[model samples]
Target: MINDQLMLLERAFLNSRAFPEKRYYSHVLWAPRTGSVATFPGLSNACSSATNTASGSAAWAEVQRQLSILVAALEGAAATLRPVAEL
Candidate 1:
């Protein structure tokens, strides 16, 4: 189950990085007058605004943190699963 969850998180993280729109949880507007502007200015400032903040971005940051932890654990598990000849 843990492996399956890790795979799901890994796939999600890869997809987010692979796709242009998925890179940021907030909407990106391309305006000639304003140039390129982010609707929420990414997750770096998720806690800046109390009432007008983007909740999805904050949740995405937590998910990213969990994914990183899962990846490290999976790497350790993979090392243990390596063949004796390779160890």
Candidate 2:
């Protein structure tokens, strides 16, 4: 389930770059009006479990890898919008 959501997010991020005119992609990543950030409860659980077991180290590493990708994508998207926001 988490993988599915991540895939969707990745696609959205890519689409946002391909079509800068679309605002929905940005909305999916962030909602300024409500001031709410997207949350993944399953990801939180995986992160917590990561610290509890040495056996899950590989899984933890993968999670961290995916998270880094997501973060970079978000930062890129935000950087693009910064100029507009400033004006």
lDDT of each: 0.38, 0.46
Model 1 Cα lDDT, one tens digit per residue, 2-24 = 55545554333222321133454
Model 1 vs. true fold: TM:
0.33
**lDDT for residue 57 in candidate 2, whole number 0-100:** 79
- Per-prediction TM-score, please? 0.33, 0.40
User: What does the lDDT read for residue 53 in candidate 2?
Assistant: 66
Per-prediction backbone clash count: 0, 0
Candidate 1: the clashing residue pairs are none
Cα RMSD for candidates in order: 11.2, 12.7
For 14-75, candidate 2 gives per-residue lDDT tens digits of: 53332133455343233222112244322343456565668657758745654654576677
The regions of model 1 sitting more than 4 angstroms off are: 1-56
